[model samples]
Target: MDKANQSQQVTELTLAGLTDDPRLKGPLFVLFLLVYFITLAGNLGMVALIRSSSQLQSPMYFFLGNLSLLDACYASVVAPRTLMNLLMEKKTISLVGCAAQLFFFIGFGSTECFLLAAMAYDRYVAICNPLLYQSIMSHRVCVLLVAGSYVLGLLHSLVHTEFAFSLPFCPPAEIDDFYCEIMPVLAVSCSNTQVNRHLILGLGGLVEMVTILAVLVSYSFILSAVSKISSFKGRHKAFSTCTSHLTGVTIFHGSILALNFRPRPTDTLSTDKTFAVFYSLVVPMLNPLIYSFRNREVKSALREFVVWK
Candidate 1:
């Protein structure tokens, strides 16, 4: 198509949300609203507890606090619009709005990946080299790690968003998923998307693989270190330190792998949407609960704060 004709294509795209059955909308809205509320309360509460409790001041909780903040952010990027879409007669987002959504979603998602790897490294140092843990994961080092995650996330988002949005969207620009995800957006494009697909597969796969490898290697070393503790009690104590993080990692990475790493047959859009819901919404709600409920230190800090108040 010529430039003039391409420019005349639909600028506002319609979203085919989670369901088309009108009867499902009310129930789905209530369900998602409840989930969103819990996500907000849980993440915000965790951040507040970490900030206020001096006893919880450590490299681990520092990262946990940031994880909570990111969870809230990542959830906010999609959940509100999803909630509105469930209620609205027409689920539409302009091209610019869609681009912004894709940017922030990818940015925060990538940041979380790096942050999880950083947290894994922190755990490795604490468990494997206790004596040098303090020096190695110093405040400055932690800050730099966190900052680097955000910077990399921003760059990743910028590249993907620019590439995805630069393509000409054809008429009948209806996205198959609930949100403006890279794959769904690309599927609706008039321009050839082989490059975009390769970029998504290559870059996205690279990030996921590297981060996951880091976590796996760190945990392998951690297991080895824990096994060296001859006493059952000592081994248990060591394992307890990583349980919460391991759980969070499992849920987050499991959902992401299901979404991105799997083969994308056209028939699997519904399955993809289901995984997206888990990754984008349910995972955020679960993170705070996983960390706070599973960790003795976090529980103790909460109890102490309550008693003091």
Candidate 2:
């Protein structure tokens, strides 16, 4: 069939998963299966802990719970299919299914970017304006922020997903990546993909720039506020509150920005796949640990819960 006919008839695309090495499949599956479960346990446990604990009755913990929820969903969007494909000889997903996956994946990702900014702003309020922090970062206001993040994330994902599948993909029509992110799907298109490419990059860059700026500006103010503290203990306490959030921000944004703004696609498949896995799988699993180990309140809460049990 011709390209046009094939595009009309094609309902699915084969996924070229992480590796084709038969020797590595079993090991990879076991590794990622462990990763996925740990992610779920950690993230979900954080959410529950935050919700159930009275000690965590603050804007920061509220945002942390939401962040944990997003991480769980974010990891879930990619991990199951990746595990399944690891065992399958011919890994395939329907075009509609691919769109759905990309929609949720990007939805969680974009929401996370804005949510991180909100989190930074929350810290700024807590540190820089402690007197008004409770009033400024009220429950109603935090709920509004989270709801706004979801709305914006879903809308952005909608536009990207709509534009993506609109293209009449070329023959073979197989996606080279594990998931249906914009760039990978675009690589298989029969039509001029320059516009879509630019659109995705432009939109993604715009969102990242805005969020990164918010985080940076918030931190700058926080630094200024911290500098006024006379006591070493006061300065240390102020800095301690920010360490976990800053660590998370650095890891999440550093990986994403590096991968997104890479000079060009590398010759090897592993680079792209590695980035995809790191952000999706590893980050989620690591976040709970980052918060648990770094934050005193979380550790205390965990201990209390353990003692109560």
Candidate 3:
């Protein structure tokens, strides 16, 4: 069909759950509910803990609080919808709602990728360039980095959403996997999705690759610097600071790579669902725990607060 005709063809779509088996519904609901609750509590708790603790007033903690907030936001976009689908019979979303989900999912997710890179740089400065750490990461500089990450995220999401919805959808919008994903959305489109698919592959796929590259490059330098530390105790402390950042990076980028760049879509969806669980649910829960609970300062603050309470 021509562009004009395709434009006028259709706009709405029907979505399908990954599995229609009635037997799986109850188990999935219970499992996802538990995951969602832990993710919410872990991320929200980290934000609150950071804010209340005076010792965590540095740029590191500031970035951490933002990271936790993004995790909560990202998980909220996907997890709750997934949970609702399991419980509800209809499992339908409007075109606008789907678009909104796509926008925020990409937005927060892109932001988290950049934020992870920024945090890696922060650790690099603190560990590798200790003398310039404070001077380089001043409050104003920190704010600018965080703002830039969000702006980049917004732009990326806009590009993906615009191209995604431009295609025509005759019917059958049933998105498997409990949320509105781009692949499922494109699958039911009446018009040929070659251009839309290429756009997603070029824009969204390339950006994710770039983000992963940036993260890997930052950590490479971090690892080299950590290895050079003379004292065993000093090296241990340095590596500990990076442990949480590394954990978060591994989960987020690893899942994206698996789901987006896989060899076959049909073969990957089941595995993709598992990757999605890691990215959207498990990672959020683990990020705060890895960072907050492992840090001496946060643990100390928690203890002091407990004693005083």
Candidate 4:
């Protein structure tokens, strides 16, 4: 049979979920269900708080609000499907469903990376050129940055998704991940995927390098500006303001690094699952706490909003 026919024949795929033990299904489902709720509530609430609070109308919060939105979306792309599959005996997903999941999962994740870099740039401007912060990060500029991030994300995801699904999947149709990740799907293809893997590494690495370089450069400038501040308290305060963004970036990029740089994440299924859970579930729920809840302004805003309500 021709390759197109072989590809067409793959109508659905089975997921080898988090565990095979039937006894553990109930516990796992409950655990992930609770996590999903917290992720949605935390991230969505952050967006609402940022939008409603007059105090949070700064460029920093503008970037943060979008980050919250992206985290919620990124988690949703994996969490709900994971929860559903946990309940089902077969854990089967349609080809289209798998494709959609992978597309959005990669898209949102890539967007978040760019968004974090944008946030770092915002911090740089605020620290390095305080007087020009407002003018430089004008509303128009912020919107354009966000739009560009999404465009880049979509392009990256589209290329990888199309390439992954284009190859004919050899049957059993079982993916080793709970969600349809690109690499796992590619691993199952009948076609020789060495070139595709290399291309993926090249493009993914390029994106990673660009974003990380932006973050590093921005922070280096910020540190330089902070060092010039003579007062100990003043310098401390400046860095304190950035602590949240730094924390969020560290956690997010740390997970990405572990997955990519450790001899490929898929080589060790247990390690892959650990980072997968970290990316798909833990990060979203933690982002609000890391970025906003711990901030003085957001706390005050929340208190005021509560009192008013």
Error of 1 at 268 (Å): 3.5
Candidates, ranked, lDDT: 1, 2, 4, 3
- Model 4, runs deviating above 4 Å: 1-7, 264-267
List model 1 lDDT by residue over 108-193, tens digit each: 99999999999999999999999998899999999999999999987999999999988887777899999999988998887789
- Which ten residues in a row are the worst by lDDT in model 4? 259-268
lDDT score at residue 272, model 4, on the 0-100 scale: 90
RMSD of 3: 2.4
In terms of lDDT, model 3 sits at: 0.81
TM-scores, all models, native as reference: 0.96, 0.97, 0.91, 0.96
List candidate 3 segments past 4 Å from native: 1-12, 265-268
Q: After superposition, how far is residue 238 of candidate 3 from its true place, in Å?
A: 2.3
Clashes of 1: 0
Instruction: Give the local distance difference test score of model 2.
Output: 0.90
Number of clashing residue pairs, candidate 3: 9
| RMSD after CA superposition, every candidate | 1.5, 1.2, 2.4, 1.6
Highest TM-score, which number? Answer: 2
Error of 4 at 87 (Å): 0.7
lDDT comparison, 1 vs 4, better candidate: 1
Mind giving the per-residue lDDT tens digits that candidate 4 earns over 54-131? 999999999999999998888989988898888888888998999999899989989988999999999999989889
lDDT of each: 0.92, 0.90, 0.81, 0.88
